[model samples]
Target: MIVAIKYPNGQPYHDSTHQPLSKKAADSKPVQHGHRGMSLEQELNRANEFYLQRGIANIHKKPTPIQIVHVDYPKRAAAKITEAYFQQASTTDYNGIYQGHYLDFDAKETNSPTAFPLNNLHQHQVTHLLDTKRLGGISFLIIRFTKYQETYCVPIDAINQFWERRKTERQSIPYQAIVQHGVLIQPSLYPSLPYLEAVDHII
Candidate 1:
């Protein structure tokens, strides 16, 4: 079967293949232990589900808009997406209503223990968040530092401050600064990462 995927700008997607490590090599590698058992997205999804079930908030991940170019049907009952293209660049990871205010945010994770790379966010996304904030909506970022197993709800103001500083100084936001300005979201059993608890502080 052949499959092709392209970005909205018409650039073809390239899948980078990685070789699997042998058993011995995999076992030999040092594993960093942390309380987080799931990725940032998964944790948030679980949290959103919890919120939804309890009638707390109606938050959800935004689905990427895509156009199917081709479909392959080898059997009558089996069909495969053979070709597709993204309709446009996504604005954010998630958006919905919470506590009578519109919520818009993106989930981001960094391996770096000291800082978050500014380049991780695109200009379009920044613009979208800023625009949302200007219109009296809640806009923020959910950032996770894998090494520390810590997640934070960083407000748009903090992002704007560091974003402007990047042009004149460093290319990343210092971990300490984020810790000072952002609210730490603790992981829980039912909701997983209880980020809205942090959002409560933000609003």
Candidate 2:
């Protein structure tokens, strides 16, 4: 059964379907130095679980509230959601506490190799991060460049700097600027993406 999901603004959400690559085709692809198969969100979820098991941190992806509008009952014991809409715009992707400090952050992926477009982030998200920081909480972003398979933990201050400059300057933050201002998170086996090490720097 197919499900129709939409945003609060009535825009339909397009869910991209992925086909598994053949073993021969997968072998032909160039080796990625970083985590290749899993998305940034998946890696983070795995890492968060690891942290929870180790008592290292308590972080989780914020669940977007959905308002179900339609449901189909194909069987007496089964019901499938046919249509749903987001209850409201989300504040950020992930949030929780880390080592006595409140941590709030969002994860974003860009296919571009040269820059991270400011348009990728919404104004409300930026405001939320700033507000979190103002309340003495650690707020930041985990940006992954798909082309390079590189991820960086960028502090909110760095993001705000470029966000303010976009009014009269370039609309996107240069990759070099991210490399300078953000800490590169190296992938690991246990937690997969060890972003907390980068967070340690921010703290």
Candidate 3:
């Protein structure tokens, strides 16, 4: 019995019983999805600048507090931050006065198709937003679905309800649920996200 091993394509090795195997066809190239290169933060910053320029609002992203541990002063130039750590966890991304109300919110981006994972939010962040709401501030979340290029302004009340329900229900909030409860925001030429237009509708 001339037992033999061969390639999956039945191509065999040397001894004249062998024949070179034709190469397999390469896999088809994947389709590339177009994406906006600007980040949520950058868009919000641009929007805030436009708001400021038009005297419509005075919103700004909160700067993270960093404790400088060491600094290298290369004389004649600016001192370089050699070592530093965040002083404290920042509460929210942006906050300021709009009209006669106080606004507080955090911007988030997700690529999830079915849902926005609550994991994107922190316990403290939730608490801060809720507390802001309690203190008569308009607290909300500016969330963007990167895959869909859609943004929404979700009021803290709706988020709080979801957070409270998640303890005994689904861990993530479905995109449809957000669509039902949140205000859809369109990106524009001036204010990139135009979140305030949604805010105006809500407030």
Clashes of each: 0, 0, 0
lDDT of 3 by residue, 5-53 (tens): 5545545544541121122311243223222577888778767766776
Q: How would you encode candidate 1's per-residue C-alpha lDDT over 1-203 as one tens digit per residue?
A: 77667556555565441122234643584354323467888778767766776678999998888899999876533466789998866588799999999999998999999999999988888889999999999999998988988899999899889998898999999999999999999766545678999999999
Superposed by TM-score, candidate 3 places the C-alpha of residue 197 at a distance from the truth, in angstroms, of 0.4
Worst 10 residues of 3 by lDDT: 17-26
Q: Local distance difference test, per candidate?
A: 0.82, 0.85, 0.80
Tell me which residue pairs clash in candidate 3. Answer: none
Candidate 2 per-residue C-alpha lDDT over 27-72 given as tens digits, one digit per residue, 9 for 90 to 100: 4853454455888887888678767766889998988889999998
Model 1, residue 97: C-alpha shift (Å):
0.8
Error of 3 at 118 (Å): 0.3
lDDT of 3 at 163: 87
Best candidate (score: lDDT)? 2
User: Which of 1 and 3 is ahead in lDDT?
Assistant: 1
Model 1: residues with Cα > 4 Å off, grouped in runs? 1-35, 72-79, 86-88
Candidate 2 achieves a global lDDT of 0.85
* Candidate 3, residue 160: lDDT: 82
For residue 154, model 3's alpha carbon misses the true position, in angstroms, by 0.3
